[model samples]
Target: MGVMYRPPNSGQDQGHKMHHKIESACQKGKVTVIMGDFNMQVDWVNNAASGPKEREFIECLQEGVLEQLVMEPTREQAILDLVLCNEPDLIKDLKVREHFGGSDHNVVEFNLQFERKKVESDVKVLQLNKGNYRGMREELMKIDWEQSLVGKTVEQQWQEFLGVIEDTVQRFIPKKRKVIRGEIRQPWLTKEVGECIKAKEKAYNVAKSSGKSEDWEGYKNKPRITKREIRKERINYEGRLASNIRNDSKSFFKYIKNKREAKVDIGPLQNDAGNLVMGDQEIAEELNKYFASVFTVENMSNMPTIQESQGAESNMVAITKEKVLEKLRGLKIGKSLL
Candidate 1:
């Protein structure tokens, strides 16, 4: 899903850039949907020739294999609003509703036609705090790796050692699965806020049925109180996160990352054939193929001799373990996606 709003005063340059970006998104070969107040006066329904900018934008959609779904006029008579999708049947029952709020453009409502993807979250985790660390240590200490792996190949030796460690962990560690009934509510939602929410719902229902002024006023006042309670609870919860960061840095960092609203997941990708790849294995293979195609590794064994420029001398030196270690020690560790 994508949203865009191109200003009317902007010239062809901005439009071209926006078109390129949208085209690239479509190239990802995902279940794509792009909607915006494009400000393009294109006659998509009648197949009439559009202006320079409109033609360029339409050409881009064509090149990217995108289909325009919205046909009705959104703002006055001209079709300034558009809903573009790569899949022809992905968008269904698109309705042009009345003007939304103070906006002049009509609200375009549509249902996406596809099975919603369910993301699997962890239900069970290793309970490291209850693990038998002493037993594991004693068991590991009993193994004489040098004598046991004396004649094995390096890979085989490493595998055998890994197998022992895994067995030891399994024997000593404990894990439990949690049963989650529904989507987990926010940790910040306290009893006061929950009660406020219930009161607000009750007031709304009473006001809707009676249509009394006092009942409506009672309903209206509930939101302000609810908001205040919610604000206080959230601040208290965040304060707790900050205070406990040393002991639970992961939770604190996770909350901070969520607040940042960053998209970290690898989006739907496609191979050279332009077919959607969704499965983890398939996506990985497609990415590998793309990276392999882009990156060409040269054979360093065949070196080319280059003549040094005049007045320039080579100052190459052999790398030492101490020097490498010193450089590594000076380097700062950073968080990276890789």
Candidate 2:
């Protein structure tokens, strides 16, 4: 069974083609059932006031030989609901059940003697040899350490480590197997961290202004500044300034607390049971575990080299074969026949 929402402005020919495709798919002994809010009336038996669009829709249904499964006439004078079947003969009974009372549309039900298709067994192919890691030491030695570490801070290095783990499971795991994953390269962090740093700097500036004001007031009534007094005031101001800087730095670090948390959140070292009670902490820990598992050197080891090759090949293909076929179909060949 398949369902779709077709818009009113989809055009007549397109609508006809959609019906044809469903019919063709069904005729291939698929026993397919297509139902949806078609957004058009198939008949005026229930709906007395019919427009050209509704009339056209009814004509199309007749042309396609779509069996109307529902016999109950709706109070709302629009044939927006539909049930189409390729193997109408297989259906023992069909009727529109009363609104179980919540939805605007009526529910249609059908009974059939149909056998469920057997699940196909998938053959697993082993591709990678465990022996490949024997040469991993050589590959690791060849990698440019300076190049890889460039632009990476302590925090970024930790994040990159987590990213490697997440990429592995997503890329290698079978689709049917359920697993949690995290998006590693979050661009939003750049903006979030930048804003946090700016806020911290602003607070530091405010604190500096307040300390300067205090110094100015203390010296306002003095006739001349003594060397000892000058040194003392300078020391006092510097101490206050240092304190402000420390506080600001602490706040900035706190803003990136999640990233710091992620660094220690995975594998045997994880503190999941303790962290789970704290929602934000738990999210950070989960993200850390996910990233740690996928974004490893082992998973993305050949990504840089493969991406370069694929990107170059993709650029060389002119217009792409897909686009060319689309252009060919767009040119009208038989408008008169329609």
**lDDT: which candidate is best?**
1
Per candidate, the number of residue pairs that clash is 0, 13
Q: For candidate 1, write residues 153-257 as lDDT tens digits.
A: 876898899899888988899877765589868889988899987887677568657979998777666767787889899999999999987567788888887
Residue-level lDDT of model 2, residues 95-197, one tens digit each, is 6543323344655667876888986556443334323443544545675667766899876776675665445433444344233358754323344344543
RMSD of 2: 31.8
lDDT of 1 at 173: 96
Best by TM-score: 1
Error of 1 at 98 (Å): 12
TM-score of candidate 1 on Cα atoms, chains taken together = 0.42
Model 2 residue runs over 4 Å out of place are: 8-17, 26-29, 44-52, 116-338
**Segments in model 1 whose C-alpha atoms lie over 4 Å from true places:** 1-5, 20-32, 41-82, 92-111, 115-138, 141-167, 174-186, 189-233, 243-254, 257-338
Residue 331 C-alpha lDDT in model 1: 56
lDDT scores of the candidates, listed in order: 0.81, 0.55
